[model samples]
Target: MRQEKLKYLAKLALLVLMGIFGSFLISEAGLRLMNISYPVFHGFDPVRGRILEPGMEGWFRYEGNAYVKINSAGFRDVEHPLQKPKGTYRILLLGDSYTEARQVSLENTFGRKVEQQLQSCERLLPHLVEVINFGVPGYGNAEELITLRSRGWAYDPDLVLTMFFSGNDLIDNFPRAELREPAYIPRPYFHLDQGELKLAYNFQEWSPPILKYRLLLWGVHNFRTLELLNQANRVLAARHIGDSQENLSSRAGLADFVYAPPQTPIHREAWDITEGILKLMHQEVLKHGANFFLVTATSPDQIDQEERILLKERLATKKLDYPEQRLRALGEIEGFPVLNLLYDFQQYAEQHPAHLHGFSNTKLGAGHWNEQGHELAAQLISKRICQDPSIL
Candidate 1:
């Protein structure tokens, strides 16, 4: 009787284990069929601070629902040869999340659009055009400069364009001793030491644990169910920690500070560090026998009249284009071309009455650029480049 009971118990345990395994397989298949998955693309890089995981592909559903694929080179765009092809004109773009543009498909990005437009230009007909995107999310000028030196130069680009986001680049450029708010992610910062530029890799201590992180990444990459769980856990963790701290996630407070002259020492130093880094980048591009240009992306608040009014009321200021002016002034004084899209973008918004920055899934006017925004930017940039044939 005892032997018979043991056999029956053993059979029950085997059936339970098989059922669980079968259920997991079914869930994975269902999720994949629905095209639902969440994967963390960016990871800590000891050199550039953080970078997208190479060859990682997934559906990004946070702000926009679009499939994104990182190239073997870890860029959001399609891969190109390291050595420039003969009779080809290559342009390298360096910026932050706006340029990375995970919210849209690779073909719909401004970089790719510019390439398509420029290729049709009469002057550049004989020469094929190639634009490489080196943009990484959360990157500031310091990381951009480092990117150009460490990785960008390999592509042998004829021109280098830095898309400066006045919204947060100033704050991201320098490292602070301590923050009254949470430090979301640590990055390599540039500081001026005795009138010379120096890089501080303060985030080295926070580098991801290799074996454990790799195991997690592997599971997230392979299984859609695991990815969903990972995202849920992340949200819960953020909520638990965010309760005690002043919400630093929103840019509301820092956005206005950029419009005026530096109010505190940190802001003042940030401006200084930003200017210094821009100069260094300009010089570096020239040294490499390439032309450099700066394009300042319009912040969402700059185009939204209601938000503008509230910001103005809060700051009690009549003018809010200080950052653009500073950037233009620096460009002019330093002998580099600078383009400010605030006026044009604002004018378009007024006449057309459409949200260029945000998507339908997200708030209409609150986040990254949408399809229309990318199209307009491409048209404007291409027009400018063609206006002066010599620029090509």
Candidate 2:
């Protein structure tokens, strides 16, 4: 009877080992087949010590982080950590993907434009201006504010400009839903407790294994899964809009392209969330003794209203939903001095019709700014800053 029991125990142990090996093989195969790349998720490298060198206008992996590169005219990475420069009025700009310049080169980014404009103005004004871009992709206002308070305050910025993109910034800030994949780490939100704002995540005190698991899951699922899902959704949405194979191929041409706005009010949560985010951002900016300037980034539809309406009707005929004026109204509130780039770009497009080229050159591609768009935005922002010296 003892011999029989020993044999049975050995058989159970063998089966368990086999199961573990099988799972490993399956997971390895999936990783190999996926051909996943770096910057898989945010916080994979929470400390911003690593720097990616300049490269061509395509995706590149650097230090295990994936980044899209652009060859903008005069863009360079600030290699050293941000420190307060004496005798200079520094300006820190923060926002999400749009501010991050996803599709545009660094030189063509609004941050660069603002910097150039400020440098030019320095000739006339005695005080010199230095603008730093603290923009990160997939970040919400909460992240921006947190970054400003934690990382950015050390730079001693006189003014903090937060560009608010109305579409997804709100959804990006929602509580659990805000927890993005590893490539895009969501900034922690702080609640006021006992008259003091505490750190949201206790990184120092957390267990290493738990943090690693969280980071790994974020890297694998958030960065990889969601990206694939978004591409699939866009394709499906395009099909629902009855786009032809040729039209789909020319999606790049429609860089300013937008699908039919969703009819459900559920999508409108972006508005409320953005407002709340702005309020939080304002408080954070004030805490740092820096003024906050809110810039309203324009949507493609806002630039071409009639064309967007026609597209909306076309999608509606196909029984597809889309966002409408309710989304636009989110920007019209009278709290801060808002720079409406949508109207400015529309007017510019009217004057320079040739500016509306394919996806690579258009201003309407997912809130990214082309060179001309950045130039215009910089000019407008400069004018506003000059007009309101108090904000400075």
Candidate 3:
């Protein structure tokens, strides 16, 4: 009996060791096959498969296309190690994912389109015009302000154009502990004091190099694992509101799943926070001797107001509120030039129905610009820039 027990114990120990070795081998093989490398936070390294520089420092791998840090501010493709040329007019473009050209290629981005147009012009003011794309995904006025203050001045921009999206930018600016780090990572902070909003640095804490490396390794080798973790996070986020019904809808046409937060009042304290961030951003732009222009984008709700209202009513029936009016009102405030593209895009879409072909038809999903959309944005923006004698 004793000899039989010993044999069983040895067999169990061998199985455990084999399992451990198997896991390690699988992880190592996965990393090797994927060619993954550790990405530096806030630094752009192209060799390691990192696209986009000087921001959150994560590998932006989507649809097999990669973007490394192009030296131009925002999303502009220009000569690296940017040197302000004697006769070049520098323009800095700032915004969120839409401005980052997430759904489109680098050359197809609006900033690149504008640059191409400017270069094509052989008329009098043809010395040289440089438009840099400083837009980062998930950034709001706070991050935009910080980026402008920190990096915009270096390029000596003659004009700074900031794009605002209604859906996420406001949410991005709100003071939430969940947005601290490792997820929804941001570089700026807003403080609300007695109805007044203040801006401050929120990026003091740094991720350890080893942890960052591990995350990179995991991100590359275990994408499915990270995806599962993200899904788990969404489930937790939904549970935070204690609501039975959830909007577990993903972005339109794309399989990427997103957790939709419970509807909150449009005029809630969040707008106050957003307003404060914008105020600081405007002031910062002026401080650098650069003119600021506010360009707005369309959300799906804005595309069909009646449908949005109905959706809001449904949420309201459930004791939830959506901050639609507050956002529009905030945009109306006096300060910089505001280009509300919601109305214009809707009108254009109505006239030319063909433009909607490339976009997803789902009303709940976010809309991306096709070639027409990009052209329209470029034309309107460029026309506005030319109209402003100050920018010239």
Candidate 4:
């Protein structure tokens, strides 16, 4: 009877082991054969830190399903020359994903839309207009400045448009702010030491992890199982590490206030620091002899009265003022006109109740702007550009 029991136990163990190995083999084969790549692909850069690998063709899974193509210059748009075409008025549009706009096709992005819409103004501006999109995903103001100074001037832009999303940019610009990103990538930030901009944070040394985490970071970025585990770990960690009164001064505490909105006292310093960064960016744009325009990319929560109500209901707060107003003030003082999109976006929402300007989160119509939103942005900005002789 004892021998029979031992044999049965051995059989059960063998079956379980086989199942695990079989699943592993299947997953590996699927990854290899199916080209099931990570949503975004990137290569480490010595200067830019991490840039989308040039000539990369991959799938982008957020906002909506679409394939992504990177130009040889490591930009999201098609190839544009380093030298501006003769008699062409070139515009360099800089921002995060909204300007990168892989969520829509090449023709549908706001950058492309602006390019197309400019044709109507041939009589007004005379010269053909070309807009080069240098938008990258997950970029903060600091990154934008770096790109502008390093690569933007090469295009010899007549006008440079920087889109500022008031959602998390304030925190992103703060080096001490905690970022609970899945990959825990390092971002470069500037520190004002005695009124001088000092570089802080080394990219390679930012998150020196053990061998297991190094491998896990690769898996989390490329594979699904690891991503699930990372997200689960984040939830658990958040419960324990969520901001407390004692850690209020800590970076994690500052980032946790993303739910609290910018009007909260904890974020006052972040906004002030961000204003300085904008002023620095303005100076850089002027050095390149390009007109700088700041576009306040209003978050989904701040666009319409209905969206504002949703935030108030969820957070139970009467105050949800974002950093756009402050950014506008800084822009005014810094000599750049901030394109306030709130009034126009709200008006569009009222006029077209069925069509949406943006999505709520990562939902198809939730987090980022929808097709209609991009069109609206292009229409408004293009009209202004055509009429404003001062910009170019």
- Model 3, span 1-392: residue lDDT tens: 99999999999999999998787677567755775533322332212112244332234333213344444333435453457888887788888777876455567778888876776555418567788888766677777776776666888887788888766666566655343224323345576878777665433334464346446545633454344345456557756632322221121111111112323443355566776777677777788787877777756544554544565564444211223334445545745666666656667766764552134332123355655666788877777676655445
Compared with the true structure, what per-residue lDDT tens digits does model 4 show for residues 1-392? 99999999999999999998888767767665766555435544545555665777677664566678999998889999999999898889989887887877778888999999987795445788899999987788888888887888889998899988776676667756343342346567776778677766545543454233445555765665454455567557757653542353343345424435554544666666778888888888888788888887756776556667877776676655445566667777777877877668766777766444444445432467777888888998888777776665
Return the lDDT, model 2, position 94: 82
Q: Lowest summed-lDDT stretch of 10 residues in model 2?
A: 47-56
How far out, in Å, is residue 264 in model 1? 1.3
Leading candidate by lDDT? 1
Candidate 2 Cα errors over 4 Å, as ranges = 1-76, 122-124, 176-270, 304-307, 311-335, 355-358, 361-367
Candidate 1: where are CA atoms >4 Å away?
1-35, 177-186, 205-219, 233-253
Question: Higher TM-score: candidate 1 or 3?
Answer: 1
| TM-score: model 2 vs. ground truth | 0.60
Candidates in order, TM-scores: namely: 0.85, 0.60, 0.68, 0.78
lDDT of 3: 0.57
- Compose the digit string of candidate 1's lDDT tens values, residues 23-80: 8899899988998778888765668867888989887878876789999998898888
TM-score of 1: 0.85
The count of backbone overlaps in candidate 3 is: 9
List, residue by residue over 1-392, the lDDT tens digit for candidate 2.
99999999999999999998787666556644877433222232242211122332233222111245422211133432457656777888887766766455566667777777776663336776777777766666666766666677777888888886654554454433322223233245443345344435423223574475455545443344444444456557655553443343242222112234433433334334445667666767777788878777765544554655665575554311122233334334534455556666667777776442114422333235555666777888887787675576
